[model samples]
Target: MKTKKILIVGTGETADLAYEYFTYDSEYEVCGFCVNRQYIKENQKCGLNITAIEDIEDKYDKEKYHLFVAIASSKLNYDRTKVYNELKNKGWKFASYISSKAFVWHNAQIGENCFILENNTIQPFTKVGNNVTMWSSNHLGHRSVIKDNCFITSHVVISGFCEIGENTFIGVNSTIADNIKIAKDNFIAMSAVVNKNTEENGLYTGNPAKKAGISAKEYFGVL
Candidate 1:
């Protein structure tokens, strides 16, 4: 089978990692890197030439090459989400990557522009939304719903029947108990344990995951 050519949008570490993973493990061939002209600091990244995002369609031809926005959560996850939406509006198709080493149940559903890394287990009946990122070694329990534009770091455990809201960032080593509903735009700090429903735009920290005085505004400069 002929591998489809893909252009990853970003020139940072995440883009480099995406290039390596797509090159070796997936049926996609990464041909180049891209970022906004203002963000381009180098001519080359991961051994590939970086193209200005404004000129991406002219150079790569959206019909011929798919795109994967390899940008991490920035500005409360709005940065990556905005880029994804813009490229999508321009008629570019985003690639959804599920590493072969990841264990995703047959009944699980994943949306476009998602990146599921190695050692991740997405149990049956789970629903992962678009532009989501699941780092390595995480366990997504059965019947859980991870909304769009969320980022889940490594070693996080989400028990069954949980609902992680859109644009939420769950840090490493966090444990979300079953039936918990994490509200939108909340930040779950490392080593936190969520046992109950969260408020929207809440900043949670510590073992029992109490609301921190630091608001989401502190992290994103906006609510």
Candidate 2:
């Protein structure tokens, strides 16, 4: 079978990282980069000429090329999710990059456009939904469900049977206790330890994580 070609969508550092990882570590070949017209700063990125997203499908031919949106966890990952949804609705195929060093159990299910990086452990029966990003050295415990568009930062621990809601951002070194349900749009701050179920748009912080009076959107300036 011919190796699939991929276009990384972004001109930022994440796109460069994706290019390196996909080129040397995965089966997909990184052909070029794409971004919205207003954000184009340079003509090229990673030695490939950058293409405006407006003209991407015609130039790349989606039938023969897959896309990987390299946007990071901005606005609780709403920005990345929007890009993913727009491309998917337009009939674009996506490519996921699970690092060769990540430990994803055979029984685990991960959806499209996910970026699972090195040393992450996705245990048995764990379900990761579309457009998710699991950064380095995180532990997604058994039977846990991480919903769509969620971003799990480095060194995080999501204990067994927990449910992470959609568009949530779990910060670096945070720990979600077993059986916990983190609500949608939650922003768990760095090193927070959540032992109880969270509320929608919650802002959690501290060792024994406590929800702040303000919503996650307000804290992140999304509102």
Best by TM-score: 2
- TM-score for each prediction? 0.95, 0.97
**Candidate 2 residue-wise lDDT, 40-140, digit = tens:** 99898778889999999778787899999999999989889989999899999999999999999999999999999999999999999999999899999
Q: What is the lDDT of residue 197 in candidate 2?
A: 97
- Candidate 1 regions off by >4 Å? none
Q: Kindly report which residue stretches of model 2 are placed more than 4 angstroms away from their true locations once superposed.
A: none
lDDT of 1 by residue, 32-148 (tens): 899999998989876888999999877887778989999998877888999999999989988888999999999999999999999999999999999999999999999999999
Give the winner by lDDT: 2
State, as a TM-score between 0 and 1, how close model 1 is to the true structure: 0.95
lDDT of the candidates, in the order given: 0.91, 0.93
Clashes per candidate, residues 3 or more apart or on different chains: 0, 0
